[model samples]
Target: MHYALNVYGADINPLAVLISRVRTARKVEFAIGAIGASVVKRARADRRFGIETTLANRDKWFRLEVLTELSKLRRAIRSCEELWARRFLWVTLAETVRLTSNDRTSTYKLHARPKHEIDGRNVSPIDVFSDLVSRNADSFAFFRKKLRDANAVSHARYRASTDIALVDNRESKKCWADVAPFDLMMTSPPYGDNQTTVTYGQHSYLPLNWIDLADIDPKVDTELLRTTQEIDRRSLGGRDPVSNEEEERLFAASTTLKNFAEALPDTPSDGHIRLVRFYRDFQASLEAMIGQMRQNSYMIWTVGNRNIAGKQVPTDTVLSELMEHAKCSTVTMLTRRIHHKRMPDRNASSATMREEKILLLRKR
Candidate 1:
């Protein structure tokens, strides 16, 4: 059994104990993806279902198997209510619809800025939901009701479980406003300036602003406040310039980032600086994360090597380097090929990133 498990690990990227601990959640997510993929494939195959075919063969086959397995894995996820899965499925279905749509209305138009080229048109949430309904009306109806009930139950539970008192620290000036013990920790840190795709500042703005859990208290100290505020500002539109001739030289020397920079138009000064600062901050976040975990705690992150300027910026490798510098141990690194369905080659000329490494680490 041990030999078999080790071989499986080798095939999938060596699985660390930390990652193995979350096998259940990973399995559930895999199952869900499988089921969702199958539904989409079957729908596309039967044009009578009105679902258009937008996925490549690789994606279509992957989704069919993963999504179908998800349908079967529904029985195994602990503490997972049917409603949660249903809601997730509905959301995924909506995404699939958007992915397959031929209309261009949904694509983001950056004024003179880089835009992600997708298939024909922008697909809407409604369109996806409609597709789901047409294809699986019975399942659709079940999830709809289940989602409503789940929200109600979640709200009640949050109101009833008052173990950790909420303290506002929005305005706080401290290295970390508060430190709380976590049961498990998983994160995919930024690879580097050139390799990362998801902008942390832009991606997190709405959630940080709207969610009460992230509310800042007025009593925060000045230093911490300024630091966080600067971060927020950079996220919005701030960019930090590369500090010296040395740093600029380093960036220029990077085969990965140079390509990305050349491919991308000159970013607004503020935005450019923010990207650099964001990576620096990401490293800090990793360090802080390691510090916060208890001894022997687990950390699993999904990262990858991004291609920039015809060279690869292995984010997984960079992060491992950072973790080691912070005195953390490298547990395992799993390389996986995930055909991102949403990443479309509109121009058919831009470099595409097709694979990612799932890095698993442990804090000793």
Candidate 2:
């Protein structure tokens, strides 16, 4: 909507898709402030004491008092008549959960705070939710004002089209085919597998338990919340094992990948296996994306070179080679320094990247 262009996006994470959908929604709720105030008011007046989540060991991550308050908030949000407003409030509730939970805030992983610290801390989910709702309402109002000023809004709705879907890119050809072909593609794919890299699934696991799965997408499976790692396992390169033939084809398509694999130790280590599997899945996703682009279309890919077994994976070079094999030519490569990041400086397996490469390519 910022550029007033029709936009479409897909993500494996349901939470991600929910957030993206709200952000790109064509319809605007001009009464967002009123709706948010009503939610808080209803939550405060309700006296329900039931916990809402069925997540295993729920007490491990939340105190009884906090859980009770969250349950009240959840029920109140559910009473909302407007689906869009409810979705927005759900996001607010999710943020409140992040702040009030026993989980530490420094990292994406769901490690609990020290027992002493958790006990010493006094937080209220209701208060947090109220404040977030107020602040977010103001921010959204400001954004809509800007859009209106730019003539991007008409009759309280975005002028252009927008579509967001919950999808696995490796198998998304049909999804993209449902819409017109795109001329420009831009994405910053995962640096490596989520488990050893960022654990996006784990980051979303807690908040997801609180939000209604049905509100996100009809196809969203509750099984994704079965385990902390379930969503990550369903993500790219998470559970699929690379076959020898597929590996050979991938190697033939990108010599940089072949060289990297050949340089690893003869003894097949878990890290080596993960590296290859991630690339294999990435290749498939790239093919699916390329298939959706129009001829002479341009792609801007931002990639990071992650380390495995103390060796750097030349992701940018490898991606360029793969695109070349798919009949695309690299227009240029640009480097950008990472000034700030949510990832840890280093993990047990490897150091996080300090910079990233942006490759611009065109379909021939």
**Candidate 1 error regions (>4 Å):** 1-179, 190-238, 242-278, 344-352
Please, what are the lDDT tens digits per residue for candidate 2 over residues 1-364?
A: 6777789999999999988877888996878888889888988998979899997988889988899999999999999888888889988998999999999887888899988998898898999999999999999899888888889988888999898879999888887676758988999888877876778899999999999989988899999999999999988779878899999999999998998888987543686788889889899999889989988999999998887777778999999999999999999999998887866555743374888899999999
RMSD of each: 14.5, 1.5
Candidate 2 segments whose C-alpha is farther than 4 A from its true place: 266-268, 348-350
| Model 2 TM-score, all chains together | 0.96
Instruction: Encode model 1's per-residue lDDT on 152-207: one tens digit a residue.
Output: 22322211111111111211113232444443566554434421343333222211
Work out the TM-score per prediction.
0.42, 0.96
The window of 10 residues in a row where model 2 has the poorest summed lDDT is: 343-352
